[model samples]
Target: MRSDPLIAVEHVSREVTDSTGTLTILHDIDVALPARQSTAIVGASGSGKSTLLAIIAGLDRPTRGTVRLDGVDLFALDEDARAAVRAQRLGFVFQSFQLLGHLSALENVMLPLELLGRGDARARATEMLGRVGLGARLHHHPRTLSGGEQQRVALARAFVVEPQVLLADEPTGSLDHATGETVMALMFEMNREAGTTLLLVTHDRGIAARCDRQLHIEAGRLKPAA
Candidate 1:
């Protein structure tokens, strides 16, 4: 069975003004990302891939057009309401691991569930950590763990929510090749098992190939069907 798209981007563009004047970061972009599938955005530096992802995740606004999440117009909502929708529907994993140095692996994973008032936060987080092979390191802080361990904890936190959408930005960029491969494999496995829609921005073609489809970008424009 085919599910309706979880996200729809329609003619979106972004521009920023600096001392050098206005710079166009993204041209008009349109795409539909179906639920429970993974799509990768690949491009060179300054290609606006991350910008597009941020816009889709409602972290950034477009100068033109709008994005819809599960048929709800993102820009149509007020900031707080949009934030609420984003928090409820989306999860993220980043190259930097983005974990708190002060929080242990289990605590970091439990934070999101706690934010949502889930009483089973500790139990769910513990299970997720075990799933990612981090059960023994549950009490280790990000600074105390290796890079791969931190990323695994990040993956656990991301999947713990079973979010409707997962957005990853260069998730392997900061790791060694061997560790990167392991993390990516685990991320795919988690995404698949949770039936979450994934939108990843990556520079590596191999990583892009892991996705269900690839959207190629060049000069701030998407190349059709890559």
Candidate 2:
């Protein structure tokens, strides 16, 4: 069965002003993200891929246009409201593996569940860590884990919420090729099993090919890659 699109970006544009002048980062972008499918955004540096992803994911607002996620207009929501929506329906994995350095792997995953006021957070977190093949490393802090392991922990924390939408920014940006492939495969497998909509910004061609659709950014414009 086909499900409704989890995210929609319509004529979105982003611009920033610095001491030098105004810089247009993304120009007139449009895309649809259907549930249970993966889509990748690819481009070189300064292509505005990450900027567009940030706008679509509600981490940053667009200079113009609209973003709808799970039927909610993101721009209409206040910051706090948007945060609430994120907590309830969105999950994110970033290139930097933004885990708390002091928190154990399991505790990191449990944090999101706690935000949702869901009990059994520890149990669910442990299960998520195991799913990421980090069963024995659950008690380790982010600094103690390998780069790949930290990313996996980030993935676990994101998926622990079973979010309706998952946004990843260059998920494998820092890993070696083999480790990157492993982590990417795990991401796809979990997304498939959970039927979560995925929107990933990546420079890796192999990663892009695995997605259901591809959107490429060039000169601040979004286009279907030839």
Candidate 3:
């Protein structure tokens, strides 16, 4: 594992069996994401972009292949260890903005830090919310916020811990162009500031173009963008 390569995915494949027989989602995917550099995984729906993100993030396991993050072999770790690694080294943003409707913005942002028993969880959450221009809305619940505001809250929550790698899956998929651009700008800015490696999953060409490198996936195969 290189110090600068925060994430390495080698010969990764994921398969599942349904009544229709075996279906392969990703095949022999190889990627090396360098620290502080932005990388995009672009593909159509069912092209396995989100699946790859999940495997790399340690949220899902591949039937075959290895994922190493910051010198830790994600699959080598047991369930609890993998969870710990994710807690300490990874941050994730999703297309759906998976926030708790019952929790306020501040509480949503504080969840990870509090789980880690960090003493500054509340202060850190408040600062992150403020950084995302949502300081005034910290007490607002998800249902009360607009789509863009909810996404901003998700962004705040993702960056609250300053993890080594940031994984975003269609982060701007729900916003209009202007709002999406603003959200992406904030993401890139925070990545730069924190020196976090960025691995983004998106269908938007504009977003892919802004990354340091682009990868294209089609029918379970991974290839460098043309």
Candidate 4:
């Protein structure tokens, strides 16, 4: 792993306006994550774990401070530049699987590579699907697959690009315990092989325990691990 921090969140906070007044979703937070390390953001629902993840991924801006990815201040870049950085360096997995229902598994996995203008999108996506144990289901659509299988497809899509950082939000939240376990195992195995920085938001302590470090959030305030 790299000695320098791959991701740095400094005094970050977020607030939004509601019907009555400003609602703060996150308080001042500071965190630095090393390259190739797996870290879990653990908290109850509405504690701003997802919000923090979004800020780090450059999908959302922080209200108070800056987020640095690979030593570049994310918020300093223009929107298009930030998006380009995200496209090239970050991969995301969500709880809902986020697969296009009409596209086949192979197509879904190939989309990222296509977006990045890779000429060998199909072949690369096929190899990724096979690696995720979905070789036989490449032609199947998301609706035709089981929850576990759908998540596998999502994983293939995220990992196909060989991103520098992988951000997953409740990746197994929609599956049964056994199936979730299997999916998570594959995810970690792939992360280890790729040596990508893994940061995930999860409510399951069991899952959090499997990561290298766990950071807790309570009512939008970040608390260091004990």
What's each prediction's clash count? 0, 0, 0, 0
| Window of ten residues with lowest summed lDDT in model 1 | 1-10
In candidate 1, list every pair of residues with a backbone clash: none
TM-scores for every predicted model: 0.97, 0.96, 0.95, 0.97
Cα lDDT computed for each candidate against the true fold: 0.92, 0.91, 0.90, 0.95
What are the C-alpha RMSDs, in order, of all predicted structures? Answer: 1.1, 1.3, 1.6, 1.1
Q: Please, what are the lDDT tens digits per residue for candidate 1 over residues 1-226?
A: 6666779899998999989899888888988888888999999988999899899988999999999998999999888988888778899999899998999999999999998889999999999999999989999999999999999999999888889999999999999999999999999988888889999999999999889999999988989882
lDDT-best of 1 and 4: 4
Of the two candidates 3 and 4, the one with more favorable lDDT, higher being better, is: 4
Order of candidate numbers by lDDT, starting with the best? 4, 1, 2, 3
True-vs-predicted CA distance for residue 69, candidate 2, Å:
0.8
Q: How many pairs in model 1 have backbone atoms within 3 A of each other, for residues 3 or more apart or on separate chains, i.e. clashes?
A: 0
Residue lDDT tens for model 2, 5-117? 77889899999999999999988998778877789989999899888888887889999998998778999999999899889888999999999988899999999999899
- Report the Cα lDDT for candidate 2: 0.91
Among all windows of 10 consecutive residues in model 4, the one with the lowest summed lDDT is 1-10
Among the numbered candidates, top lDDT falls to: 4
The positional error of residue 151 in candidate 3, measured at the CA in angstroms, is 0.9
Q: What is residue 52's positional error in candidate 2, in angstroms?
A: 0.9
Clashing pairs in 4: none
